[model samples]
Target: MPTDIAFLAIAEAQQLYHWLPAALELARRPGVRVSVLSPSDQLLALVASYDPQGILRPVRLRRPPSRPDSLFRQPSRLATLLLNYATIARFPTLVTTEISSAWLRRVPGFTSHLILIKHGAGDREGGYKKRHADFDLTLVAGEKDRRRMIDRGLCTPEAIAVGGYAKFELKAPRQRYFYNDDPVLLYNPHFDPALSSWVNHGPAILASLESLTGWNVIIAPHTKLARAAAPIVSHAPHIRVDMGSRHSIDMSYTMSADVYLGDVSSQVYEFLLHPRPCIFLNLDHRDGAGDAFAHWRLGQVIDSADALPQALARATGLQPGFVAAQEAAMQESINLSLVPASQRQADLILNFAQTSHPAKS
Candidate 1:
């Protein structure tokens, strides 16, 4: 059956890394039309590189009068933006990596179905919130999310389904950067001002790396951090600061690093894909208890800069002692599959087409 499905990317960077692979997969399916719509030109350009034949139709809308510059700038008002976009788009089914766009189902004039293709496999509390579970259909990566959402009473099994990690299947093998066989650390920090260590312990850690010559560091903070007006600076000869580069979205940093030093971002799951040493910064002063802090069990948690060096040594040591913990965390955090995830996602979308439930007038 011929079907029309649209993949919407509100942000170009992180989402393109997740959605482009699925778009390419769905494009190859017989009698399926896949369209990619994004407000970010950089994201669109990146999508274009993978779509030279124009299989993914591009959709752009004129700014509604007095509309906020971007949905992210004023996220609380996305309903207005989506309402405006509804005038431009009428796809019976719209797929997105953002939960914020679930409002697409609530647009008054249109009765479109929304399927959320979750962006990453992170254990962040917000990612598992009830709001994140709001969608006509939600494609989860593993059993962890499906169970978590059901346990929270957020969404029923009927609405949520497992589709594996689509990005990993599309991921090419990484070419790691090695400097004289030095043990490299990937310092990945979340961009949340209050929850992230970047604004607090990050500069100290970077300065510490500059003074120390023993270890090579990749200061690859969340891409959003680099979007600041200035480039994040790290003058250390052994350190490289990567802020949302095309390479940042790839698995290079995670695979190349021997130890993962991060706070609150789900990329640690990516680093832990092979069960390596990890150190998490607990700037929020959580006691490291309960389901929310399950990831803290995966690595040594440091609260202050005074403990960073010792933590790093233990973190990079041959027997970091956290190996068992790292393994346990990965099992709880990700659902790895032998099946190509993109193919699984395409299958779901195709099945969804046959049984889609668009809102009725």
Candidate 2:
């Protein structure tokens, strides 16, 4: 039988849009045939569009429209345990963002390798300990995250790393393009109510930006913002809130923007790949909460809507030394490159798939 590699992605719209295609390309090497198994229509379209020749097969799983209590309350490990076995039966190599050790137990021919790409904060790795078991390899993009995974006994030292951010491997530019005609500010708010400025101050921020002149604002919010009932800036001439319908996950906005405004979303890290100045919003400064990014000391962290205008002023007038420092720190944290990150990731996946054999027991 031909070597088949299956990539399981979250049913969520944005995750599918931004993360899935990169994984597909990484898997489509000489020995492997890649398939994307996801529930989001956006994901299906990306797979089809990225490889119209049917080079990568797109498989849509039947999933309930409304999220179930079990899945919603406890995601990551448990959710992966429930949905991944079906994919294991058809494909020997599995690449996923969320992997459950519990699911690995039940697969009939389960010797296949699993490579997990960690996409969130370091704190989210707590559940991995409960489901801990052996896997071929695991990749992480953040150093703090790699440490947490190691401390939790989730995977071995060799299996984890502050590996390069996967999206860094995708489309990138030789040098950041900054247009002096008008400063471009990209606002990316997290979807989580407790962690996002959009949940609390989006309307106020939108209204404030609407009144201001000069800076061009691109509100590329979390994809979930598209379906939010109390959504921010439904239709604004100046704002471009991501609808997820028309946009694919290109990081051009990150490369070109002069400044970034965001909450606790990982998109901020993506924006930081180019080492631009950013402003972080602190909606709830619940002290000792231990969201390390909040204390990252990379940029200004503001606590109110009123401070935004001044923050924008400082961002626009950033000194050359300050810009250099922030960019250097961000480079150490994200470790991105325009040339080889994705291609190396692609090579790793293909090499693993070719060398590993199926389970005998």
Candidate 3:
């Protein structure tokens, strides 16, 4: 009999990309049926785009009719899981990118083995929740997360696997966003109010970028943050502000930009895939001494928006000084291997599904 495995996409659309590659890889194999389940039509469409041959099944999960529509307008992560409980419970094994889904294990009749594929490689405390211990298996990008989770008692070494960064397996066609050849700088800020530089210094940073003469700027904040705020507009010809578009999530900005400017976004590690110039914002006065801020060691960390111009000007010249550290950090954050990460992740998931028992409520 074929094993029934479903990839649950209850989080943001950005996370779906991280799981799709593995789902497609698993679907291609015999004796395992992979299905991509989502509440959003946009997400299902994205899966269709990737699976042109219709290999992986697409299942659209619906909100319960008894639930009030207003309450579900912007459903909480837990609510989304609860509302779709009946449909989700049918699968013998379910894979999700967010830890919030672990709550499902407590629901009556929800006996599916819950597997977590961590969505991001950032070192924020929010990423390592106590709920992680509830999952039957967890997959991480590299040694950094594996060590952190074990040390924090979030997951046992046997329950977690360092399957590398599956998101890197996704390939997006490169497109030029700026007309001029002037070096492009991507300013990507995290959404967390306490840790994000944009919460306090966003306008000033944009204002400072306007005065820059030789560089092009792309103001693309984290997708969650952009969705919450009103649409952002850029009047200057040299500056473009993208408030959550497909380009923002598809690695277009990261692959195209020559320099990176950000707060605590994991996208910086993606930008580091090429080892370019990077500048970190420490406007929140975060202590730069811990493992959480380990990425800060890769570039110059500026405390104020006033230092923007000078930092950009010095980034290229200072890049050589940081290249070795950046390379080492990238290796530690994402374990690149001869075998594709998607294949490794698929193998892990398949093995877990065949061997692991259903999670207890």
Candidate 4:
């Protein structure tokens, strides 16, 4: 029988975009029955468009549009687990891009090989956790993660492979929030309270930008940010506060924006794709040295909310001096080579899966 592999998109349905490229490529190969499964009709439809002839499984959950962050994912997980036995028996290699995939290891009658292709490539410490190293195989973004994981004794060198960001290969049109020719700015804040500026400086920063007539601000925060507490609403003509819009999940806001205003989100790297002006909010006073906060060194870093206006003004020029840093940071985050990263990742998984047998739990 052909080796059966399944790509699960339960954690973050929108994040399903990250795995589609590789999954589509895998489905085209011989002796592989690739399954693209998700609880979201929207994501499943998008996945089907990429591989119309392949299998598309939409596992209905108790929660509509079920995602790891959905208001009620516990019922979804419980229901999903109840249906996992048959799935594991057929598809022994289960691939996922979320850390929560580790939960599947405990599923009854499941001895599948769990593979992880992480969602983002950020320099933040939260990205490197002990839970991530549990997967049988991890498809990392680049050298930064691979080196750090091995050094931390969290991941074995043989168990890891560098499979650039496949989502970057997928097509997503840039979205424009404003009609006129105002320069766009993205104020993306991370969800971590200790590290995020959203609590102490996000509102103040928005208030400052409201008076600026030239720049249009998109205050899109990490999706989980609003879940933990009350949503921050914006009422400024020059600003658009998006908690978790399609524009936020896709690279729309990042591509459309001219200047990047962020603290520790990996989306900053996506914005750096075009090498625009960047202003980072350093509310926690993180060290710019070493890999812990290596991303902060890419652009102008401001510690106080009061400095945002001046920094944004100066950063609009994007200073010619920051070009080298932007290029360097972009390199560390992704392997933007001429070759198609999706096909490379698919081939790697195909080769590995063909050789290994399913584990018996």
Top candidate (TM-score): 3
Error of 3 at 38 (Å): 1.3
Q: What TM-score should be assigned to candidate 1?
A: 0.87
lDDT of 3 by residue, 120-203 (tens): 888778788889999989999989899999999989899999888877777565568788799898999888887888878778
Clashes of 4: 0
Model 2 ranges with Cα > 4 A deviation: 16-28, 39-42, 60-87, 100-112, 120-135, 142-144, 161-163, 172-181, 225-229, 234-237, 246-248, 286-291, 294-296, 319-321, 337-339, 355-361
- Which pairs of residues have clashing backbones in candidate 3? none
* Model 3 TM-score, 2 decimals: 0.95
Per-residue CA lDDT of model 4 for 14-111, tens digit only, reads 56667878887876777777776555555566566766665544444334434444421222544554565465446678888877667666667667
Q: Please, what are the lDDT tens digits per residue for candidate 1 over residues 1-361?
A: 4688888766545666676777888888788888776554555676787788878877654333443443223223274346457543567777888676755545567677777787787776677655665577778777788888888886788888888776775454655565577788888888767677777666676666676557788888777666542567876678888766667877778877888888888888888878888888886587777665678777888887557678777665644577787776666556666777788888887788668766433
Q: Using lDDT, give the best candidate's number.
A: 3
lDDT of 4: 0.74
Clash count, predicted structure 1: 0
The C-alpha local distance difference test score for the whole of candidate 3 amounts to 0.85
lDDT of 1: 0.72
Better of 3 and 4 by lDDT: 3
Q: Which ranges of candidate 4 are over 4 A from the true structure?
A: 49-79, 107-109, 316-318, 357-361
Candidate 1 RMSD computed on C-alpha atoms after optimal superposition onto the true structure: 3.3
TM-score of each: 0.87, 0.77, 0.95, 0.89
